[model samples]
Target chain A: MIDNTLNRRQFLKSSVGVAAVAVAPGILLYGMANGSSEGASAKVRWGMLIDTSHCAEGCNDCVTACNKENGLSGGVAATDSQWIRKIEIKEIAGGRQLSLPMMCQHCENPPCVDVCPTTASFKRADGIVLVDKHRCIGCRYCMMACPYKARSFVHEALHDQNPDVPRGKGTVESCTMCVHRVDQGLQPACADACANKAILFGNLNDPDSEIAKKIRTVASVQVRADLRLNPGVRYQGL
Target chain B: MYIHSAVLFRNRLFYALVALAGIVVLAGLYSVHLMEEHGHIITGMNNQIVWGIPHVFAIFLIVAASGVLNVSSIGSVFNKHAYKARAPLAGLLSIAMLGGGLTVLMLDLGRPDRLLVAATNFNPTSVFAWNIVLYSGMFGAVAVYLWTMMEGRMKPWSKPAGFFVFIWRFILTTGTGVIFSFLVARQAYGTAILPPMFIVISFAWGLAVFHIVQSAIYAWTNKVLDDYVQKRMKNLLGVFVIAALYFVVAYHLTNLYFARQSDFERFILSDGGIYPMLLWAGYVLIGNVLPLALIYLPGFGKSYHVNLASVLIILGGFSLLYVFIIGGQAFPLSIFPGFEVKSTFGDGAISLYYPSAPEILLGLGGVAVAFLITAVGIRMLDFVPHEDTKKFH
Candidate 1:
């Protein structure tokens, strides 16, 4: 009766405080149990599908875009770190020709991860393989173990990195599937740059994703399917 | 004390030899410093051929280290009284060579400073991780074994110590071989025969190293290694070299049998330009056949032929490793099985690798380091086998 004139604003504020106190512990517990931040969920397996049929022979837009995206600018050569490159293929028997981009296959069972002594080479919860630069001893065992010849060792000191991609000398690196972009719900630079729409990037676990649909409906092949690595990268045409 | 007197510690020639070896070790260290400062770009190794000549030297030393311990094992484990006197020398060489090899291996890493990470971050599935434990444990086992032989009161423990190291070295070598064998992706490695093949090669190389050191020590003291001892050691070496050859043949034949692997086989066996030459002329001819002939042929083993054969075997060993490690990478991986591949990344072509001066210097530094260790250790202790050794044999 004495405080009735204190106003509805005060009363509503107290009520809100009481409600938060009652629900905050439960919310905190839920957050603690889940373990990932917003947009960093483990339910997605990021993958790419390269339709070799549509991939133009002379177009280097994807490679250039990847370089710009990843900060692999200078000292490019046969020995330099090339996260992705174009491979021209011709069947020895049939004499049929094709060209495809090759990078890390991001295998379900990667030989690189198995050979890394320091556990530097690891696969993310979302099935993206990466080398932990801090832990990579640069023994280069991963390069030897990779069937697709995917990994490259940084032989020289790096400068002017793209901030997001922290590269250095004496560590092994491969295509990360543009993980920074993926976290922000953006397509990989390579996929985005492909004008012919030959590259499609999406969560392989999602049934509705274009990559999933193509893999199911189309006859696709991994570079070395005999290894049974179950690579995340697939090609539509040989 | 008797052994120590024979070490020739005061000789000008001895000091000169030690100084030369020390200088070589310094040069090697300088090369490593340059590599660390400038990065691996200064070296011959690249993305395609990741492991280069440094590995050749390191592996050779490590393999020989395991073999050197076999001499001690013959005394303590096999109960050969003749070998008992030489146990201390063998143990010392084992430590020295292993230490040198490990130094080269550690220094060659991309992050040599991150050696602590290798110790802390253990991956159970990785053969490389297991090797750290095996190699470390081997050093401990060998040290204790050496102590048992050197200490008068600990003589009773020598056999047990020897037994431990014998088992330990086998496991260690198997672990080393598994480093290659576990690589299922490399067509040149991961064969079933690799572990045993490495074992035999270790024996051949290790015994050869032992003979060379022993001979040098005897010569320094103005004594001759007993004819009986030389003959026995030579015969054992011959058997080991022949066994190694058989493994190589069987390994190639197995690859040849598979239609999918025929190209790889042809590349290594015949068509592979340098590789075929290495296997045939280097490993098969100079390394195996000549050594065998020198050992078994009636008049050959009587002269310096055995010593020459030992040198040939070692040279052949290096060539064999070069062909295996470098040549393996040179042949392109079978990424697109039946398709001819061309890429800026050297996808379909043979990777060319020529080791630079720094690489060779770094490799030789490991050799020099091992020699320095042996020279210093022998002078400090009675590492020369007792003259009683000849009497026992």
Candidate 2:
């Protein structure tokens, strides 16, 4: 109304200084969001634990299944917009060479959420960071924000999408952890395809579930754990 | 339009641009064609380097576009005449730069038909989302600035628009750097210098575009560039070369300083490495440091050599970025330590990313679109200040 653009520039002219003054209140809100002051007192805190040892050679079943279920084009194109991919980690010197399936580790303190100007892919009450495809402008910042190369962009439309695979164009997407199927009491596409039954699926909060059991029994790892994302997917032997 | 104005084309520069533009466009077209015919499968980009050339070029173009404001902002904000004449051209070029960048990027996409979705469906947290807004906003800002400048109305909005556009342009470039820098898990971590590097690349590429476009405008209009303005543009170019060189060194050295990512670092810098000789020879020496030296040396001030340095500076900056985007994605997460994966790093990746035949044709069509738009813009809007811009012809 009152030339906000110009007024905004004035504020921005001293932006660094403004940032300093803004930090205190910003930190306050941040701490609350991070569940630091309230420690384990947030609503629906979703987490992950990946058993890396389970992600073995030629075992890109999760990746393949995710692609098929997601209706992603499996082609020799320069980019596939992979929602999840199997990462082969030759851990420096013979640290039990590992192949772990990496996905959108749905971070608790999601940087993807932090940088989004529109608040489209906000962290929900249940803590699974997701994109509302309807609201998505498809800028791919989430792709950049994700430490794991998890999100994929729907750069174009499919001629005939596989009826089984969930597909869309003009928006970015990722391992919704099969949010659609999860809502209907179905396991994720990957967990369904895993032959070794290596892929464990269950609520992390449920103390006796197989996912929780594996986490407790085996030494598991999460990618970039230092970032304090408290990932839902934990890995074993990674 | 005076057809008899003095400083028109004399042999080298214009012809060279025509050649460069023609070659780049042809290459882009051919590559896109290759991608389309064979599918993007031809591109060296696997899931690892999902964003190889297009991402880098897109960022490069955006950064260059952002820096196009340097001359104008300094002139308007600081009120220096040194770069004032070049401002309008800079503004227009930023628009062309955006178009070019977008064209290259669209060609890189798996399904370019959905480009409209970038504006329609929104992932608010996605930088790609914000970039859509930022780029659109920048295009608008630059478009208006050009209008106001051309119409002789340096209104209150004009100054702020100019200033903010300059500021946002840098932010836009920094946002691009953040796109890469934010990837903490990617081996590219430990280098926080991306934002600054984007700025330097922005300045270097911006000035290069500025110089080239200035030559074009002069060639077309048959107008002589005032010696004073040439000197100023040359000075700004010199400054950009130096800053780019400094930041390039700082960024790489900072990463090399950290022992944690050292192996990944060496893989990118040493012989048999994807980035190896390119980093030292092409990027560091030729792209940055050497060009910086050539421009800064006392004898070369304001000469054709300065323009030569600017050209090399742009190519070097572009090549370095190509190395980062392509070469960065060359090897696997070298968590494998002591194993040879593959050498399809730089030269090989370009070929690997060979776009299908239809893709190449469409890419050429897109480049045609960019050039056509620029030509139309030049004809319609007065991209140059009239002789009376300084209040006297």
Candidate 3:
């Protein structure tokens, strides 16, 4: 008798090892697919460079596009959700006029994130500041702390929300930098809508990206740079 | 031997007061329901002016609540015999007022139902997070402090409890001031002096509240508060009110000196419509100056005049908060320096705010809740002291 017990134990160990080896590759591939968006790495910091000089005085293409894309064209006047808006600024001394779209700067050191009690206002690994609506108590302390005044409180009940951009009543919201498009490897709506090539969007950290190349060639200014928030959004010819 | 104090539940006056408070609280609850159902659009607050009258009331109650405990702290911690008798009432008022303030703050949330989120998921860096812990901690500390004072066997524990409370209240008020002080965005609030300033104002406001309640209790029980006790407390209040004014002046002067902050200073001191009037006439003249003169003046040392000063101080407290909370927001954020900017959003313009009825009701409801708690507490326990001149001396 050739020790039947020994033979059975060896058979069981060999079978278990073979099963794991066969199944492991499939599980690893699934995990990789879920983790990477078409192999887009999080090492790339997304940013925007706007040439205000190229921007037209009255053209609201970017604003309208953002509204349409974000489902904010509703009649919530005085309490309207304005994710991005064109601001007209004139120098008091020189009578020089400048127009630029203002939105969340997507700061590396966001004061809104700092003041939020529930950590509802948070920055993603990729540097996009977002409000977690489920967690926000809507105390508006973040609004007070934000130097740019980029955030808005949802003042009324919202219906007919865009399936792509989810929003609701009793929560604070602001520009998500069209994060859905970004995840899918596409430009933001505002950048896509710019007829005069005023808005440029791309990966800031990538040395070969168009935005980084342009920023290297020309001077760009971040609004309220004195605060040293290290804004992802930069303006040319302000 | 100790003389046991009697509870005051049988008075018809007590019943009437409790009933009135109950109605106010109900009204406040109804308003919260309406705001929750219809949304914040029903209120005067817009996106620009986020915090409104509710904040003014809430902050005042919170600061005053901390200050109210000073009497007990002085008695128990510092060994002042005169204040020992008053310690129990002081502890009661502090807890009640703090509860009232927290209630308003909770009801004002966009999703009051999600209070669990705030309690559980906290940002350690945020002053508000610290406040939640401080405020919740305060209730437990103050309740035990009150217990230590009330029970004969627990008398030995009172001093340590009072010491803990004194230190805690200081930190609590400091955190409250830090909520604004830490804001780098606001030109009006960036200062190290804010915490100390809040402490002084808390003292004045808290003492004023204590005086009003004390007088009412004495009147109700057909007893007299010793003249020496009245004189000492009122005189101390006068000093605190003046110190508060001095801090206000120093704060403004500091702002006025900075070129970047000059416009904001101007807006608050002179040009801004309601702010200037409230700051000068309401807070400085009526609240501080007139009261200071009354307390220090010879003939005005009587209980009637002292009470009048106390009432004015309380009113002045409202004015000061109105200026601090609303006025701070009214002056627009300096988004772009040296540039005149205009947008669909109210930029380069002072955002308008008018307090609505629902907001007022909610604030009053907080006050009513505080008063109701105090009334119930005194009715059930020996919170009020049996003050005899001989015993105190």
Candidate 4:
């Protein structure tokens, strides 16, 4: 009797696992086909160039813009969901003090992507680190693995979600490079909102592009360059 | 038969509690929905302290749960027949811990709906991904072991599986340590203490959880937890507490001795105020010192005080984990050329955060689920023992 029960349990477990695999993909494909291809316009390898020289000390337009576009929360409280941040980097003693506009570095080798127990957080073929919200199990291992603290966890129920970049509680979120808007050939809300042009959006791979030219003609460094994530985003002295 | 049915009817209390937890979880699911739709606004977490109470609690519970299983596996694998009787319980507890821990994680997320994304598209590079695999394997083993035992299928092959679980548990704990260890930008870099720290946490949590559950069950059954068992567990906890304290002292001393930057870091233990409070109040007082006193004292030993100490130590160990993850994250390294740059996540700068009601309720639901699973297994299986009590015990 016990053996029969054990066999039945095993059979049940296997069948459930199999049935899940069989049915899940059909639903996922249907969803992704509806969503992942939302941007049918020119596919751009979105990158950032934070010009520390002109940042208005604490004008959080870029932060708020990303939040507004991506549907994030902002406040005086140190927010867990920082799609962007402005950090003051002083030059040692008496030189220039610069404020950095920090966002996801979107590394070529994102540590967060590296340590995920599941492939929920993955780098798209186009070098974008995207979380397949459908597959994310809320483990937050990616949050820990992310050196930049770039990821944020939704700790509570937030239903008034933005349609463009929809996110829910219990999953990790970061600057998506506006996967939604960028699909339509639109620039990120942060770059679009930066009146000072303190932020630049372009393709890092495009040598003919202004960002690539700036990197070539002048010198810029990525944050924590020593960590060797090869961050796509670059900063001009902060 | 009706009397037996009456006993089963009495279990309705447990069922009612489970149902109550389910309702709370359903309410919490609304909070998850809110977080999913709007963003993480229902809680106090901000950019400064993104990983808050739920993360710490989940991680701590998992390590403790892993340790509970380790105690049983260690004995079984190594021919320590003395511990063999406790193997089933340990196996059961491990599954419970994993379930409880994962549920905490699920609720803590900004998007619990996408949790499956982690598994379907596994990232080999992500430590979190590796943790998923490790947890899957660990839980899979324990669950299988438990199921087999319940079905009276325990065989020679079980020992090898137990041995595998025993070895990998240390690795899993060490890997958990490495998660904190690899943060070079953070002041916790170079402590080389994370692995041992988890080991201590695992022991404290495991023993505490063990005693807590056992004593509770024994209480319900109107049976006294044997004096010998209580004495042994208390002594074991006392020894671990001292060792954990020693590691804390040695770790801090070594840090301060090596790097002056750590002086500012030591503020966590000293000047950081609440961190120190958590240390002295949480880790030292509840986690180590009080438990030590309780174990040594004779009066408390006669009653459920040992069980009570277990609960306290479990809470204390949880607090220490908080100090480690949250407090550790809070202390910014004084790496700026001249002065200490405060951590975005630290005290004063710490964005006030706690587990949202939904988060806690979801955690409770996870516990209920685990208990319900265990109850069902116990009802249908010989692992709960059929007739002969002394044979397995």
User: By DockQ thresholds, what CAPRI class is model 4?
Assistant: acceptable
In model 4 chain B, where is the ten-residue run with the lowest total lDDT? B383-392
lDDT of each: 0.84, 0.63, 0.86, 0.65
Q: What is the TM-score of chain A alone in each candidate?
A: 0.83, 0.74, 0.83, 0.78
| lDDT (Cα, tens digit) per residue for candidate 3, span B1-393 | 222342334355679889999999999999999999988888888778889998988999999999989889889988877788899999999999999999999899888899999988999989999999999999999999999989999999999999999999999999999999988988878688999999989999998999989998887776788878887898888888988889989999999899999999899999999999998888988898888878888777688788899999989889989988899988989988999998888888898998889989999999999999999998799987766577555
lDDT of 1 by residue, B270-388 (tens): 99898899988999899988888888987788537877888999989998999989998888988888898898898888888889888888889999999999999998998998746
- After superposition, candidate 4 runs with Cα above 4 Å error: A1-49, A56-82, A117-120, A124-141, A151-171, A176-213, A216-219, B1-39, B147-155, B182-185, B188-192, B219-230, B250-264, B297-305, B331-348, B371-393
Question: What's the CA error at residue B324 for candidate 4, in Å?
Answer: 2.4
lDDT of 4 by residue, B1-393 (tens): 247876776688667856775675566566556656666666555544556766766787688778887557755686655456567877877787777777777666655565656557766665565677777788887876665544555665677777777877877787777777765556555356877877776876787787777666565455655555556667777777777778777767777776655654567778776778988899889887777778777666644666677778877877787777677656553323342233233322433346566555555555665565555554444332122235324
Model 2 CAPRI quality: incorrect
Quality of model 4 by C-alpha lDDT: 0.65
lDDT of 4 at A6: 52
lDDT of 2 by residue, A164-188 (tens): 4445655567777776655443567
Q: Per-residue lDDT for B341 in model 3? A: 92
Model 3: CA > 4 A from native: A1-42, A74-76, B1-10, B391-393
Candidate whose lDDT is highest = 3
Q: What is each candidate's DockQ, to 2 decimals?
A: 0.64, 0.13, 0.58, 0.25
Off by over 4 Å in 1: A1-40, A74-76, B1-10, B387-393
User: Could you tell me how far off, in angstroms, the CA of residue B266 lies in candidate 3 after the best superposition?
Assistant: 1.1
